[model samples]
Target chain A: MLEIKGLKAKVEGKEILHGIDLAVPAGEVHAIMGPNGSGKSTLGYVLAGREGYEVTDGQALFKGRDILALEPEERAAAGLFLAFQYPVELPGVTNATFLKSALNAVRKARGEGELDAMQFLKRVRGIMKSLGMAEDMLKRGVNVGFSGGEKKRNEILQMAVLEPRLAVLDETDSGLDIDAMRIVADGVNALRGPGRAMLVITHYQRLLDYIVPDRVHVLMGGRIVRSGGPELARELEQKGYGSLPAAA
Target chain B: MARTAQTSRVTAPAPALAAQLARYAGLKDRLAGAGLPWLRDLREAAAQALAANGLPTPRTEAWRFTNLRPLHDLSFAEPVALVGSEAERAALALLPALGRWRAVLVDGRFRADLSELDGLPEGLAVQPLASALHAGAAGLDGLLGTLARPDQEPMAALNTALMEDGVIVRVAPGVKVAERLEVVSIASAPAERAIAFHPRLLVTLGADASLILVDTALGAGAAAYLNNPVAEVDLAPGASLDHVRVQDEGPAALHLATVYARVAERARYESFTLSLGARLARNEVHVTLAGADGDCSVHGAYLAHGQRHIDNTSIIRHAAPACRSRQVYKGVLKDQSHGVFQGKIEVDQIAQKTDGYQMNQAILLSPEAEVNSKPQLEIYADDVKCSHGATVGELDEAQLFYLRSRGVPAEEARAILVQAFFGDALEQVPDEGLREALSALIAGWWEREGGAG
Candidate 1:
């Protein structure tokens, strides 16, 4: 379960998220829909504990614990994951090496035994096969020359491998084609269970069609002005975000 | 007293140059092949040049970023013959044994007892430089001191003036050396005194011959010493040579090395220097593509920490048409260490259609760590394709955050990124085993200097 009470944040001198309150309970998925520059991505980043985004006020609670004061790694160790909109390219680090280091670090922090090379390889290969990724992708540098679709797929693969309790999907479908969106959706759908939760951030209603969020919230003017069930996405798609309530 | 002082000041070179002159003056009688007229003349000329130029000061154009004042102040004694001990042999065992053909040089003198030269294929000759000189080897007529000129390199000039012993390797025309050749140079100076030795290596690969050379220089114990080595390589038409040099001297050691190479038509030459030791070290390489279609690549990686100063300077000349050259140098500095990379590529008028590329990158892990990178390109041919770039920066914060977000600790994340930064340059090594050995060496260095910093 995740809770954000009056999540007000700012980048530089400008305020982005202005006192927004939202919550997604266990075993459910939520979608935050907004127009451009509506601070949808800011919510995802602020929850992931990224630096430079000053949380002017409010606290983010995951599993009844405040994560705002933890470092990014500590938050990650506490079962939080952020699928970046744009994955950074690591020039000389192979994807396999990066994943192994990350998995082991998280496992160690959680007081669990680390996987050996063979065990790790077997598990990774299985997940990669299910995701329809070629084995060579693991051998290449991390996202150095990956295509848009491949990057999204790689991010999904990482999410599946890490298995965080609360996953934040930040515009995962922005640059993807329809087929890529379907594949990413299928990957996310495969990971859905009673013990996990997801917050999907998107600018359009097309992604909601694949993931089918349990609830939809319309974020406008740095606040969530509307909240409804799945039917709200269809209504917004038909009428557009221009019909949202004015800011307080 | 004033008249005497004036006379001495007028006659004497600068203090540093005077010290070097005095050292070389005392070393003249002990130099190898002193009876040989040509060798004597070479030493005399070099001594005069060294006295004229003195050691390169901070004001010198080539050494502006590197100060030799520390090297100038030390008084280096002539290297004495080292009697191999159990400790020395034990120390040598720590080096990576990657090659089959191995030669060991203790204190710059070839150690036949420690060498393994049997089973060499026909048309291949490997022997000590002193033996080759004394025996009047047939190829010695015009090979020694040909590529490295004293006027161009003063430290090389100093090396020439006091040269002692080294190795001579020759591969006949059309002969392919199947096994890699290993040359291990170990310096074990006395604890109280600083010793200096010049080791010269001449490698001549005949037409159509192929060879791989791995040269490792290390010091034993905690003694202070100077290991000055000059390696000259001549690759004939259609020949190829892969050279890997690792300098892992002692903490109190000073290492100055120069490599001169002449690549012939359709020949290929590749070299990589891994610098990880010495209080102060400079590895200079000069390569010339003498014939058309020649290809040459020079790459290096340097790690400096704890007041260490490491410099990698290279000059590549494209003298023939349709030649290609590449240079990539990377460095990581920490804890008040300094790293310098100066690479110059020259394309002559006759070398039309020449393609040249050079890149230098550095990562400073500490606030006091410094790096100076200079890349120069001189093209007389208008049609040549040449590009050069240099970058100095701290570790990428975004990359660090990404790695850390994955649960990697701050120190582990930094070590991984630093290794990756050097991976681009290390991949240039042609041999996989040697490359892996060097990579492991870099990892060990990171564990010591990179993790905490």
Candidate 2:
């Protein structure tokens, strides 16, 4: 479960998310559709506890706890995952090692025994196969020379492995081809369960066709202007957000 | 001389002062009586220049970065004569078995009993400089005196004035020695804390002949000993040679060496220097590509910690047309230790098509640790590619956070990055065993300095 009440966030001294309220219970996929300059990415980053995002007002609660005070790593350990719109390239560090370390860190923080290297490799290799990622990607430096689509796909692979309680995919399908988009959506859908929630943030409705969100919200100027059922996504896909009625 | 007078009433050149003056005085009279007239004049000039310049002071330009106050602390006179033991002889036997033609300098004296010459090829001769000096090889005096300026550097001058016995390897025209020439320089006990060694080597490879020179220096005990060494290498037209120098003296020892080399037309020379020793150690190497199509590659690595001061300075000159030179030096300084790398690549006007690159990088784990790196390039040629880069900094915080975020402890992450930092330096080492040994030594130094992974 996730909740945001009166969330007013400013980046670089300019307010972006102004007075927003939202809630998502378990076992549901919520799509946040917004036009350019709509603060959708800002919301995702703020939820992940990125630095320099001044939370001037409001509190974000994840799993009934204030998530605003946690560091980025602490938030990750607390079962909150943010698939970045663009992943940072880390040279000289293999993806397999990076993922295993992340997994063990979270496990250790949660009072679980650390997985051995063999155990980690077996499990992560299986996840990679299911996500349609090549085994070679595990050996190279993390996203050093990855294609745009490969980077997005790598993000999805991380989401599946981490298996956080709330997974927020920020524009994961933007630079991806149809096949990559489908693979990414399938990877996200594989984690759908009764105890987990998903927030699919996107600019276009094409990705939603495969992931199939249960609820849709139109975010404008850092606030959710409209909320409706799944048909709202299809409605906006056809008629576009320009013809939508003004918020009351 | 300075330390003895300052600490105690006893002056320097105490126990051996009379013998010291007697040894050089006798040698000077003998050279004056016999040998080439020109070489006799050169030796006298070198001695006179040394008496004037004296031991290097911190004020000297070449010794600016390195302070010799510790060296001046103890007065050094001629060491009492020391003989080799059976254990020392046996230990000298297992020396990597470099070549059929081998030369041994024990306590600065040439030891024929510990040398091997069964597999030596013809047209190549490995003999003692003492014999070569008496023979018609006065050309060595010319090469040594001209290649390195002794008056300019006191240590080099000291080595020249107090010169002892070492090997002189000469490869004749079109003669390629299939085996390597191993020169093991050992310092004995009586020479322990009191003596200074000036072990000199001269290696000349004739046209089209190839040779390999392996030099290793070993010291005894915790006493203060100084090994001031100088080597001159000459490569003729179309000749090739590989030189590997390893200095691993004892803890309280002071090792200093300078190598001057010349590569002729279409000749190639590759040299590497690895230093892991002494309280204060400095190795200087200057090389020149003297003719067309000459190529030179020089590399060095020094790992020091725990108050050790190591300086490696190299100058590679491209003096001929169509010559190329490459220099790569890397170091790791931990604790309160200091490491210095001052490398220069000079290209003259005739040296067109010259390509030179030099890079020096260091990882400072502690704020107290220091690394002074100056990579300089002086070019007078119009058509050339020359670039120099020097970087001195700590590890990247972002990479560190990324590693720690992955569940690797902070210590383990730092070790991994440090290993990668010195990876290129070790990779350049040609010998696997030596490379592994150096890597292990570096790792041990890191851990000893409280770097736990």
* Winning model by lDDT: 1
In DockQ, how does model 1 score against the reference complex?
0.74
- Judged by TM-score, which candidate is best? 1
Task: Give the per-residue lDDT of model 2 (tens digit) for B116-199.
Answer: 765567878787876667676655655645676676666676666667566778899899766667788876534334677787
Candidate 1: give the clashing pairs.
none
For model 2, the superposed segments whose C-alpha errors exceed 4 Å read A1-146, A149-248, B1-43, B77-146, B169-195, B211-224, B244-252, B275-277, B426-441, B450-453
What's the CA error at residue B231 for candidate 2, in Å? 2.4
| Model 2 alpha-carbon miss at residue A80, Å | 9.1
Residue B94 Cα positional deviation in candidate 2, in Å, after optimal superposition: 12
lDDT of each: 0.89, 0.77
Interface RMSD over true interface Cα atoms for each candidate = 0.9, 3.7
* TM-score: model 1 vs. ground truth: 0.95
Clashing pairs in 2: A101-B406, A102-B406
Q: Candidate 2: lDDT of B293?
A: 92
